[model samples]
Target: MGSCENQEFECKKQKPLLIEGPIIVGAGPSGLAVAACLKNNGVPSVILERNDCLASLWQQRAYDRLKLHLPKQFCELPLFGFPENFPKYPTKHQFISYVESYANHFSIKPIFNQVVEKAEFFQSIGLWRVKTQDFEYFSRWLIVATGENAEPMRPEIAGIEKFDGTVVHTSRYKSGSDFGNQRVLVVGCGNSGMEVSLDLCRHNASPYMVVRNTVHVLPREVFGFSTFGIAMALLKWVPLRLVDKFLLLAANFTLGNTDRLGLKRPKTGPIELKNATGKTPVLDVGALSQIRSGKIKVMNGVREITKSGAKFIDGQEKEFDSIILATGYKSNVPVWLKGSDFFTEDGLPKTPFPNSWKGEKGLYTVGFTRRGLLGTASDSLKIARDIADQWRTIKDTKNICNSQIALQM
Candidate 1:
């Protein structure tokens, strides 16, 4: 190992099979943020990423018109602000640029393309054995920043495979230019579905949106202020039901009631505005206008896909050239930590303290709960602080133990 400021950097010496210190899985925004913090604190850690680039979601899954639902000022990583020229709401490219900048700023050298196959904790040794495709790393702690959007979840309707048309998930959808002049069906009523549908309309594609349930859609901006500001204000003072009523009234007055199209106005609270954490209601950015203007047609959820088209649960059949499944994503945590009795009954990590993971010692998960768009970043900051405190406590305890041993000798 190499000495740095009189302390040995564990990973400096390349053993036949052992690498050291904390191991971070995933190189997304959360992973990068954690790495940056660790580096700043002089903590020796290794980040294992499955992709060659950081923020693979931004580089791959994001659509062209996608903008940060949260303002850039709040969306930035800790200690790093967005560029001066960046828009208040940055585009996908701008977000990726910011992530790259963060990595460069921190000098974080993550092992690119190193997919973690599995991880097992050696309780006796107090080390986690993380196996990748090419190498195995032993670390005292593991941070599963794999993120919630690890895998895309596509709806499995009957006869979808037989359609013989272009079937792609929103994750694979880059732009709507290719669907030009074609009849398109956007499955799901999430933000991605609405955004893609709007893009399709702009691209001259006749787009139809499949809404399975009534979604509470709010404007990105309200009363010259960000919708998130309004949400934050309301969440503090107003009751959830009252907030829902106010939002519903606003939607009806502005976007019109989608109930006539077989979708009901949700009686729930206002759409949580933060960012696209896959849980917050999709903001209705011109989708309602497009629908009302006859640019896009709203349809019920798909019952089954047919050879020619699809059959909706409402008994309506329509033919389309392409189907964009915006069904959402699945958290594949078991792939790495299978048989671990730490996850919730629903397979999510069990967090006794709300958003903080509790079952595993020296292990933590961030960005798992979809509190909203800013939820990941917010949770990341909290988790990072908590981990730092824990690390400091351990170091202090070790120092005390060493001093006591020396005194005894």
Candidate 2:
């Protein structure tokens, strides 16, 4: 109803664009999935992305050796499946291409390089004001799909600032070839840690993994079927404890007591761990083999970083040429919507990860709550259906009001 002059926030002072449908943030898979679903339901939306293109994490940040942790069937977007010729577990590049095809197939267009600097809700108008660098948008609904991996979670270690070796996060790590013949230490035993260590080994680099806590190291496949496939089938029917027990049994049968190899078996099941802590176990490709063969060494938690390398808590000091932190990332929610009651002080949802998918007050979050592509697709469908239902109700109410006014006239 009003232009940029009436907006509360101080922005670039340009004419504001008003939108009826949701203004989705981030052009990644979660954002794209929700937008496509809304469009299919006859509700158009706008996407604001900070990156140059869609799925920038997969396209630009991921390592060269990255592949889908889950099978392709489980990774497809809503109403779109991976090509028949694609691998069961598509590589990072293949997945990126599929995302591009999904966007093209749906004709979804996003405003590129538009980073939303601020967002404010106006309850009286039932609209939200979202401001970027150059423009401001007001929309009826706001969907924050900025995702969890947008910011890397770097840990502070004593003397790390003084260390002279190459330090990089997994997102910046292109390939192991760059550190040829160098001794490297990779902190954290998540998927990235395993994969990066394996890559470093392939490049003739001495890599050590720092396992600071209990970890579940699972074989990627058993009996030629993905372990993830088995979990999907049994996770619903079986109890969490039972599933954990079964997976532990399977892990032992597949890879001998990995605890003996320095990876202490976590008391909790892999699925439960992921559900609770949002940390998935390492699905081994070749990292386990190298670890078992003594090619890839394992270390305890770092006591402190030295000028050359790190000293472990076990009172062992090792010199390394570089340290690669596969330490994962935290949610960037506070950067835009800080002090909002929907999130905690740390920017995590007040409701745990599961309940975070459905938000109140015309606000919803997609990738922030979900785990993978399948979860994103499921959340997007639910969100689109909810929005469509609300739209239908408003339209019917408006029609009835207009008819009553005509009769009075």
Candidate with top lDDT is 2
lDDT of each: 0.74, 0.86
What would the per-residue lDDT of candidate 2 be over residues 207-321, giving only the tens digit for each residue? 9999989889988888899888887888789887787787778889999899899999777788887888777888888889999888899999999999999999999999999
Off by over 4 Å in 1: 1-20, 271-278, 345-347, 393-409
Candidate 1 similarity to native, TM-score: 0.88
Residue-level lDDT of model 1, residues 147-221, one tens digit each, is 778889876788898897899999999888999999998888778888898999989999988888767677777
Error of 2 at 228 (Å): 1.0
Q: How accurate is candidate 1 locally (lDDT)?
A: 0.74
- RMSD each, Å: 3.9, 3.4
Give the number of the best model, judged by TM-score: 2
